[model samples]
Target: MSELLSIAQLSVSFGPVKAVRAIDLQIRRGEAVGIIGESGSGKSVTWLGALALLPGATISGSVMLNGQQILGASAKSLPGIRGKRIAMIVQDAQSALNPVLTVGRQVIEALQLHRGMDLWAAQAEARRLFDLVRIPSAGRRLASYPHELSGGQNQRVMIAMALAGRPDLLIADEPTTALDVTVQAQILDLLRDVQRETEMALVLISHDLGVIAEVCSRAYVMYAGRIVETGPVDQLFAAPRHPYTRSLLEALASLDGPLRRPNSILDGTAGAMVQQQGCAFASRCPNRAGVCSHLEPELSAGPDGWRVACLRADVAGPLEIVA
Candidate 1:
């Protein structure tokens, strides 16, 4: 598969606080990539920065899409790429959708903008898209408002709007965040199905490792504002080298696993970006050492593309060396 998007040395800052720092990632054609971490992990901010969507944010980076440099591009050029080439769906569908408009009208508007379709053609395509996302009574539902539908249905409508653009890439930022367990599963399955059927590259952002594992073959784990680990999901889950990654696994509650009491030793969540030069996770890491507090680890891989950035791990790169 060809590389669809490439982001390098990406960083976002709001005033004195840094939200995302030096993020490097790539997405290929027709593949699913997942970003998982805590709420403050900068998972969503990275993409928002990449797309130049963050207001009052200072973004310094290179974002390439199919060989074109998109980061910091002129505002006039972004519209051509945002929806027509790449679409996004947020977590809260109700708020994202305009309350006054009918569900179908919102999607139809996107169709008209991105697809250049007339009212009749856009409406027809909108209904088809609603059916594609598996909404029931696709035709009649066009008149319904966002509040009139269930959460799942509203999410499906949002999905339809995204698909109406027929984008080559779709960024889903916590698309299932506001749903119950069953609905979350359903929405994930729907996203998977849509990706497979359309052959569009998918980037799913969420805090749930299990959810990422279910939908993506490759995943990136973030902490603070940096990507701590990136590799095949199965490999990371089976053998999580980073202390933070392991802690995330330990945090998950499952019926199949034994019940345990809460354990939170970290002083704060992963969202804060400080001026400290050392590793951001060292403060919370159980394996913290003298070296961790002074030297930040560089993310490197050994040709296999499994990258990790931890002074405690044997991840310095092409040549293996014990810390």
Candidate 2:
């Protein structure tokens, strides 16, 4: 599959504070990829900056969509591509949805804007989308306001609105946040099903590694505004390379294994708080050495695109294909 979106050397900063640094990411057509990290890891900022959606932020990088450069594209050309080619669904559906307007009206407006459908046709399409997202009473729900529906249903509506654009790529930022476990599972399953049905590229961003392992084929682990490790989900989950990745996996609760005492690896604050001239994670890293404090590790990669940024990569062994 060809790349639907490519980002290289992407950096973002607000004044003196650097939110993201030298990030590189790629999503192929119809692929489900994940960006996993804790809060303030620059996961959302990376994409938002890529689409030129961040105002007053200094963004320097190349953002290519379908082999065309879009980072610094003219304002006129950019708007047409945003919703039409790459739609985004944020975490809070309640915030994204307007309270005054009916859900159907919001969806219809998206259709009219992206698909240029008339009022009647847009309504029909909107209903079809509601059904596609498995919204109950699809026709009746159209007239319902945002507050009337459940959180999961409202998220489904958000998905419908995103799908209204018929985009080649969909960026879902923490789509399942603020939901019950059952509801979160439902929403994740829905995203997987929708991606399969639509054959659109999916970029799932979440703080939950379990969610990433559940839905994505590949994942990029972010820390201190940089991609610390990335690889096939199965491998990354089975044997994590970077210390941060290992700590993240260890933090998860296991059903079958005996109780393991929690470690203090994750106890420290986020890496962003420190002004490190070298490895940002060295301060809290378990395998930290004298060299780690003075030299930052460049992200090293194998031919399969499994990459890790750590000075002692040899301790982790090489990344290999599962099959």
Candidate 3:
């Protein structure tokens, strides 16, 4: 699988606050990757900054898509690449879609804009996309406005609109955040099926470990705007190396065991933005040593291609927490 997207030393800052630190990531063709972290961890901001979607953000570093640099592309050049090459579905479907416009019109607009389909062809394709996303009464529902549709239905419509472009890469940012548990499962299943059928690369950004483990083969764990660990989802979940990763795993509720007390890491919130000379997670890390408070750890590759950015990774033990 050739690399479809590559981000190196990418950073995003708003004035004095750096929302996304220098982070590197890569995605290959037909890959399903997950970016997991708590809110403000820069999971969404990294991609948004890469796509030039963050207005007034000071973005630095390189974002390459199919060998083309997208970070500093011209306004005219970006539109051609945005929806056509890479499509993003945001968390809030209601706000993402125009309430007044019928779902069909919105989807048709995307098809006509990116796919270059005629009005008649666009309508046909829109219905097909709706059906693809498993929207009930696809044709009739297309005429209904976003406000008339249920939360899950609106999400499906959003997915359909994203698919209308036939994009090579799809970025789903907490796509199931507002949906109920049952609907969340449905959306995840739909996304997985669509990716498999289309062979399009997917980047699932969410805080839910179960959701990430269910769909993504590879996963990256971020902390305070930096990637702290990354590996195959199964391996990472089973034996997380970074202290933060282990803490996150421990926080997940398990069915087989008695409920365990949440770790202190969950209680501590991310600190305010300041120049950090050490590990960003040192403040909350249970395994933090004096070295961790002064020296930032560099991400180093370990066994089985697992990468971890922890000074104490060598001493880290297997996570006892089971999901």
Candidate 4:
């Protein structure tokens, strides 16, 4: 598949605090890529910065979509690109949707803006989109306000509105965060089905490894505003090269095997602190060496397009080396 989007040296800063450090990422057409990490790892900020969604953020990056630069582009050009070519569905569907407007009106507005359909046609298309997202009572639900629907139904409505634009790439940021396990499965399945049918590129951002594993073929592990590991989902899960990655996998409870005790890395979550030098994860990393405290490792290519930033990529299993 050809490259649909490329983000090069992307970074975002608020005053003296840098939320997203320089990072590079690419998404291919019709591919499902996931960004997984603990909260405050710059998973969502990467895209938000790319799309110019963060206000008061000093963003420095080159975001290219099909060879056209999106970052630092004129304000007038972004609106056309945002919903028409690229769409994003954030967590908290209730907050995303306007309380005064009916679900149908919201979807219709998107269609009218992007597809340029008349009210009558947009309403018809909205109903179809409601059906496409598997929302029951599609027609009736269209006229209902966001508060009138359940959380799952509201999320489905958000999905419907996003799909109404028929975007080429969809970024879902913790789309199932507020739902029950059953509903989460349903939403993930719906996203997969939609991607398959539409052939749209998908970027699923979540903290849940299981959620990413369910819908994404490839995954990127982020830590402290940088990508620590990336590879095919199966390979990375089976043999994680980075100590952080291994620690994250160890934290998950296995269904078939005996549950391994979670590592100390899982004990407490911390926001990315100011790191003038050295590896950002060195403070919490079990494998931290004298070098790790002084120098940051670059993301180096590994076998089969896999990549790791750890200096001791060859070291497998839990680390005995401590800072």
Best of the candidates, lDDT: 3
Give all TM-scores, in the order shown.
0.94, 0.95, 0.97, 0.96
Q: What would the TM-score be for candidate 1 when compared with the true structure?
A: 0.94
Q: So what's the TM-score on candidate 4?
A: 0.96
Q: After superposition, how far is residue 311 of candidate 4 from its true place, in Å?
A: 1.3
Model 3 residue 4 lDDT score: 98
**Clash pairs (backbone) in predicted model 2:** none
Q: Report the CA-based lDDT of candidate 1 relative to the real structure.
A: 0.87
* Each model's Cα RMSD: 4.2, 3.2, 1.6, 2.7
- lDDT order of candidates, best first? 3, 2, 4, 1
**Which lDDT values do the candidates have, in the order given?**
0.87, 0.89, 0.91, 0.88
Model 1, stretches more than 4 Å misplaced? 257-271, 315-323
Select the stronger candidate by TM-score from 1 and 2: 2
The CA lDDT at 246 in model 1 is 74
Model 3: residues with Cα > 4 Å off, grouped in runs: 257-267, 321-323
Candidate that beats the other on lDDT, 1 or 2, i.e. the better one: 2
**Pairs of colliding residues, candidate 1:** 40-271
